[model samples]
Target: MALVHLKNAGITDPTKIDESKTKAVRLASEKVGKDLYRQIYDITFIEKNGPRIEVITSSEASAQECSMSGVDVFVVSRRLGGP
Candidate 1:
C-alpha cells in the first residue's frame, strides 16, 4: 500500500467538510480495505505565513475522498516513511 498526501487550500473550519467524502472512504474501505492505513492532518506554513490544511491518507482512494469533499486540493504525493 502506498501513502498519499493530499494538500488543499481552504479556511480551517472543521464543520465544512463534505459528507460524501466520509461516505466514499467508508465505501472504499469495503473494497480495498486492508491497504488503507492511517490518516493524518496538518497545516503547512508557506514563507512563515498563515497555514494551509493538509490531509495525508494511505491510498489513492483516500486521496479521492478528500477531493470529493470539495476542497481545493494542491498536491497528492506518496509518503516515504517507516511503519
Candidate 2:
C-alpha cells in the first residue's frame, strides 16, 4: 500500500500574474494558511473518487500533524495589488 494514493488529480492551467507579488515568504505563508482554512470550510475542492469527496481539513491541525511526523507543511501564497 502507498500513502497519498492520488489518482486522476488535475489542476487548472497556469495563469500569468497580473499583480505585484509580495517578496516576504512569511507573509505569503500566513496568507496561504488562512486561505487553506477558508477552502476547508468552503469545500473549494473535491477529490476524485467513486463518490466525489470534499477535501476538508484544518490548516492548524494539519501543521500540528506534520510537526508530529517531523515534517513541515508550508501554505505559501503570492498576491498582487497591495499597500
Candidate 3:
C-alpha cells in the first residue's frame, strides 16, 4: 500500500476543520506508514475556493486515502507513467 497526499480543492472553510479530527487523520496516516514505508505525500492547502490535493499514487488508493482523511477527492482524469 502506498500513501498519497490529498488536497482540498473545494473547501469553503478550512477553518471549519475539527482540530481533533484533523489530528486523527494525521495520526492514522502516520500509523499506516509505520508498518509499511508507503510512498507518502503532503497535501498542501490552497485557496479556500479551490481546495485541491495532488496524490502521487494510483487513483484507487488515492481516493481511499482521501476518504480516510475526511476529504472529498476529485481526481483529474489522467494517466500516470509507471508500472
Candidate 4:
C-alpha cells in the first residue's frame, strides 16, 4: 500500500502529466539493488470537473494479495487540510 500528500495543488490535466508526475505513482524495491523499481500502474483522467480526485492502483495477480492491501492508497493536499 502507498499514500501521497501534496503541499500544493496537484496537476489535474491529463495531457500535462509529464514524466515527473507520472514517476510518483509506483513502488520501489531493493531485492537486487537500492531503489530498484517498476511501474506497477498508471493514472489517467477520465472526466473533467470531477467531484473528487482519485488514485487508481492495480496488481497483476489471480487472487488478492492481502485483505487490507489496497485500503490506504490516498492523497491529502494542504489546501484541504490547514496547517
State the C-alpha lDDT per candidate: 0.31, 0.25, 0.32, 0.35
Whole-model alpha-carbon lDDT for candidate 1: 0.31
The order of the candidates by TM-score, greatest first, is 4, 3, 1, 2
Native-to-model Cα distance after best TM-score fit, residue 8 in candidate 4, in Å: 19
- Please tell me which predicted candidate would have the highest lDDT against the true structure: 4
For 3-78, candidate 3 gives per-residue lDDT tens digits of 1222134323445333332211221233344233232332333343443323233211243454333233333344
Tens digit per residue, CA lDDT, model 2, 1-83: 00121222332111221113312222222224632321122122222322222232333224434322221222223334855
Alpha-carbon runs more than 4 Å astray in model 3: 1-8, 23-36, 39-83
Comparing 2 with 3 on lDDT, the higher-scoring candidate is 3
Q: Compared with the true structure, what per-residue lDDT tens digits does model 4 show for residues 1-83?
A: 32222213343444433433343344532232233222244343233333334454543322223222233333432235545
The residue pairs in collision within model 1 are none
- Give stretches of model 1 more than 4 Å off: 1-32, 48-83
- Span of ten consecutive residues with least summed lDDT in model 2: 1-10
Identify the leading candidate in terms of TM-score: 4
